[model samples]
Target: YFQSHPAIQPATVVVEDRAHPSTSELSPTWNRTDEWYNYRSNPRERVHVLAALDESSYTGGTMNGDHPIAWCQDYQGGRAFYTGLGHTKESYADPAFRGHLLGGIRYATGHTQADCRPENGYRPLFDGTAESLADWKQAGPGSFTRSDDGTLTSSGGMGMLWYPGQDLGSYSLKLDWKMASASGDDNSGVFVGFPPSDDPWSAVDNGYEIQIDATDVPEKTTGSVYGFRSADLKKRDRALNPPGEWNTYEIR
Candidate 1:
């Protein structure tokens, strides 16, 4: 079910699933050259699309306006990943492209974890704006500082920042994070399924924390359902980027 433009051309690659390891390190929009491919039927109904070609940036596109170039899915008992990238010899030598290929390989080989469920219509809880923090309340000592780049950095934190909006039931939360410390010795977490409370400990007692301390024990380290079950360490390690590099989390 493959169709393509006759000649290799430059196209803008738009990242759709930044939470996927294969696309986590990519910018929202990037330019690359490839023999753009189209399918007889859009696979968005089946696989989770990681990236797509921006048809407006190029001349020939057979799939109308939507053309997915990279995707992943769960197979019989394993996994499958596909990408229209790496069509040129230079693609293999590009660090970013190599990392993308490695991530896909890791996912397909069961060395990393990714939520390959088809995603659609996600509303933003925090859209990285100073105005978005209006409904959020800080509990305890430390607070987060909003930067000019639309990022919130934690400082002097023995506390927690939470949203006290409508209760979320059956939801998916996605966020990008990076440790400021070169040593990767930062401690933090995203608490979920908690009730409204002024005390940060309320979350610890009533809900779960997706822990984010890489130096801690398995049960308390990154990807762990804090103090309850440990994540697959091998998979987590493979999925985790080093400190100072961004990582995306998809918590459902």
Candidate 2:
């Protein structure tokens, strides 16, 4: 599917050994033969991998489903899009859903016409850089360290980084993300319309958080613009590569 879709390139791909179930799937009494699980559970490794992939392909998001749905971000600002509507053969044949996916790709890849209406206009502020890390400095009291494996890790409460010097008054901000797993509440998401001085918590209180948590309540999963509106993702699948794999995300 990727090779044929030349307009969309595979940025950072992960081909994990699928012969075994994830550690979360194994019982404690089982042989416990998977050492890879230990390596994957390391936060520093995870962040490094995420940052590396993000830098390489301009993709930042998770794919928790069993099927391969491309999560992508636009290099330009103002739109983030995801479509979990690719699990079934019938869905693959649905023109409307396919249009949505293609539209998202076009928007992210810089091929779509922009809708400049106040409510729909997107003005990109941050382009994802080492300087962007400065925004998180105010997040307060978190350790930022590179692991032996070269992944960046941050522990403690939530932190955030946003494009500085902009107030998105009436633009639409889209985020595409997936949970790291099918169970447990390992939540992560995009924070939108936040004040430059604010942290993730303030964004949650004043702005909005479009949740990517699949296990969250239906109102909060996939396309939900956290606490405001819900995306109508009718079907669900869990064929995504395990947690350590790269998932694409687009936030406009």
Best by the TM-score measure: 1
TM-score of each: 0.69, 0.40
lDDT of 1 by residue, 1-252 (tens): 686554788889988766577877777677988777778789987888899988899888878788999999998888999998888887888888998999899889877667786767777777656789887999888999886545678989579999988888998888878777787778898999989898999998999999888989999999999999999999898878778666778899
RMSD, one per candidate, in order: 4.4, 16.3
Q: Which whole-number lDDT from 0 to 100 does residue 178 have in model 2?
A: 27
Question: Any idea what lDDT model 2 has?
Answer: 0.39
lDDT at position 194, candidate 2: 67
- Residue-level error in angstroms, candidate 1, position 155: 4.1
Q: Write the per-residue lDDT of candidate 2 for residues 1-252, one digit (tens) a residue.
A: 222121222343221111111111211111111111001122321111111122123232332221222233322455444332344455457554455456556544545322211122333232223454454344544555533322234456666545565555645453212244546355766777666664556777887776656666766765478777776665223323224332333445
Off by over 4 Å in 1: 62-64, 89-93, 120-155, 159-161, 174-185, 195-207, 214-252
